[model samples]
Target: MSNLTIVLIILVIYMALMVLIGLQGRKHSSNMQDFLTAGKQGTLLLVTGSYMGSHIGNGIVVGGAEYGATYGIGGMWYGVGAAISFYLFAIFMARVVYRNNYVTLSDLLEQRYGDKMTSIAVALLNAVSNIAVMAGQIMAGERLFQYIGLNPLAGAIATTTIVIIYSSLSGLWGVMMTDVIQVTVIVISVIATMIFIATQGGFSIMAQNLPATSFEMIPFDGETFIMMLGPTALFGLVSSTGFQRTVSCKKEKTAILAPVLGASLILLFVPLPVMIGMYGKALWPDAASGTIIFQVLFEAMPPLLAGLLIASICAAVMSTSDGILVTVTANIVSDIYHKHINPDADEKSLGRLSRISSVVIGIFALIIALQFSSLISLLSLSYTLITAGGLVMIVGAIFWKKATRQGALASFIAGVACVVINKMGVSLPYASVFPLIPSFLAYVIVSLMTQNKNAAAA
Candidate 1:
């Protein structure tokens, strides 16, 4: 069969499986909670699948490939950062938040901050950030199609439509189950590629073929190196849309186990891109770095194998896209609709709203993706906002009892203000310099000051 035919067949099979899973999940999804949280019955394996699968999107594949081409195998720093964040999640934040049994992170934010306005602000921030992240995934998928001689816009629409249909119909249960299958295929494809490259030349030949700087882990100059490494490592721990993973878990154990194992697998899988990047640099150094992985696969493999690699990228994009869609809908349904619009709404009504919200947000995101020229710019801006605001409040709620409502509110405001300023091209030493440190410090200071009042009163 032709490579394009093979690719079509693989996608058809993948979509068929997704639809089947969505249908089956419908049996268990009787209420908003069931639809959005799998009735809180997620196992450790499912949790791991959902967390890792949703995270391993076009960002890692496209951006990591680009980094690998420029920075050599040391580009594994992305996964390294993610793995450390997962470890942090397990020991510190995972169980604490999940055990509280909150349906959304905004739930906790509202509870701790005692400010309805602050909670609503967070929900809006999360929704906007999610759209930006989804846009990046669509952009990457478009680039993938361009590699295979298809129109990029058509590719984005096709991928986005498939994801929205499944997620909007079946919600988190559908997304999680499909994620298991998608992540497994991705793991298999990446591991097999890594093994092939290693067998072909091992590391020595690749090192000789590439620039010396590419092989060095610490090749970047001092200031720029710190700028890159610090954010990459801690970003996951601080500002991730982690509520989806936590809420889907059957219990706290699933939450902790999934992130740990999922992160470990991510680290193990990094060699795939690094190897592909090195091989592509050796053969097609002049190609756009983002296109290196696809070019290398087509050059070094048979048509069938190349199709399989394309399928893996498809799996990664779909898995991540569905998770973001579900989470964004969850926040809208659980945090806003039920809380503000109709506090007495029935389960059936809320479930219907959840489905509708998913479709609406997914379509909106698809529109943005089609219109935007710079995917990375959108992704970075989203992360900067989240890390500045949501990350501090969410993390503080888990670890600090003294973290009062006022404190979280102030810190959240600080983080958000910094992000806006940075977006406007104004540099602030603390806020725009990087999100984590200022946000972290602001949360601590505000929390402590608020606590002092209680102490004085007592």
Candidate 2:
């Protein structure tokens, strides 16, 4: 059989397994709460795997690889930023998330501000960010399809369809079960790929062919590193998917510990793909940066291993995609419909709505993937938006009891406005991150001014 044929066969089998797991997971997710939050009883293995899986999509795959191809080992700074966020989250917000029986981060906003506008704003902004991140994951799948000699559009469509199917069928249960398998497959593939490269002289060969700068841990200027790292670090504070995963665990300790473990694993795994990209740079210096990882995969591994890795990558990418879909669905069904329209809806009705919402969100994500071909570009924008007001408000909600609804509203407005204004005419270095300054100032200044407004109630 042709190499492409073999890869396709493996991919098909892997997809079939994912669907079957989703079907089986349906038994566990009979109700809205179970579907949305996995009944808030997820085991450490399952929760840790899900946490890691959801964080390791196009950001660490295609984006990281392209970074490596461009800046060598410095590409890992992106993943490093993510790791920093996870650790920071564990230290700062784990206790707060675990103590509260919240299904989403917006719920936290509601508790702190007690305003429907704040809650809805949080949910909607997060949903928008999730859509962009999901697009990045689908883009990764699209690239993998291109590598297999298939139509990239078809690959994007098929991948989205499959994720929506399984995700809508079983919700977070299916996502977590499949996530464990996907994480296992991905970890193994990464390790095996590294081993295969080692046998071919690995970094020694890479060093000989590439510049000495290729080996530098952080290849770029400090400003570039901060631009790459800041949003990702703050992202863990406001991420809807991360919030859902945090609440899904069986215990507070599990909720706190899982992200720590996941973050450490991510820190370790970040460099593997960077090295792979460097190897590809050594092999094909002129190839497109985004295509370098797959080029290295096909050239370095045996056909069977390559095929398995390809299938694993597809599943791994979808792990995050499906989680984002589920989070958005939660916002639709619980935060909007249930909260406003019919608070007494049964599990069956909510379940139906959840499925429909996930599919709808997936469709939107597919559209976004088509509009933005660059994984990091789409991701950077999403992360920037999430961190702008989202990060500042989350911090205030957690630490500053004096923070008021009006302050949150003002913070969000100023933060989002800064981003828009920056996009229009600003010419600063790392412009994407500059909005946070105004966001934080708005939060603190407005909250202090508005404290007496809440004092009447107190």
Tens-place lDDT per residue, model 1, 92-173, is: 7777678776666678777776678778878888888887788778777787788888898888888788777777667677
Clashing pairs in 2: none
lDDT of 1 at 189: 73
TM-score of every candidate? 0.90, 0.96
- Worst lDDT 10-window in candidate 2: 54-63
Identify the leading candidate in terms of TM-score.
2
List clashing residue pairs in candidate 1. 113-405
lDDT of 2 by residue, 351-447 (tens): 7787778778888999989887677768878889888868888888989878899889888988888777877886656766888888888888988
Top-scoring candidate (lDDT): 2
Report the Cα RMSD per candidate. Answer: 2.9, 1.6
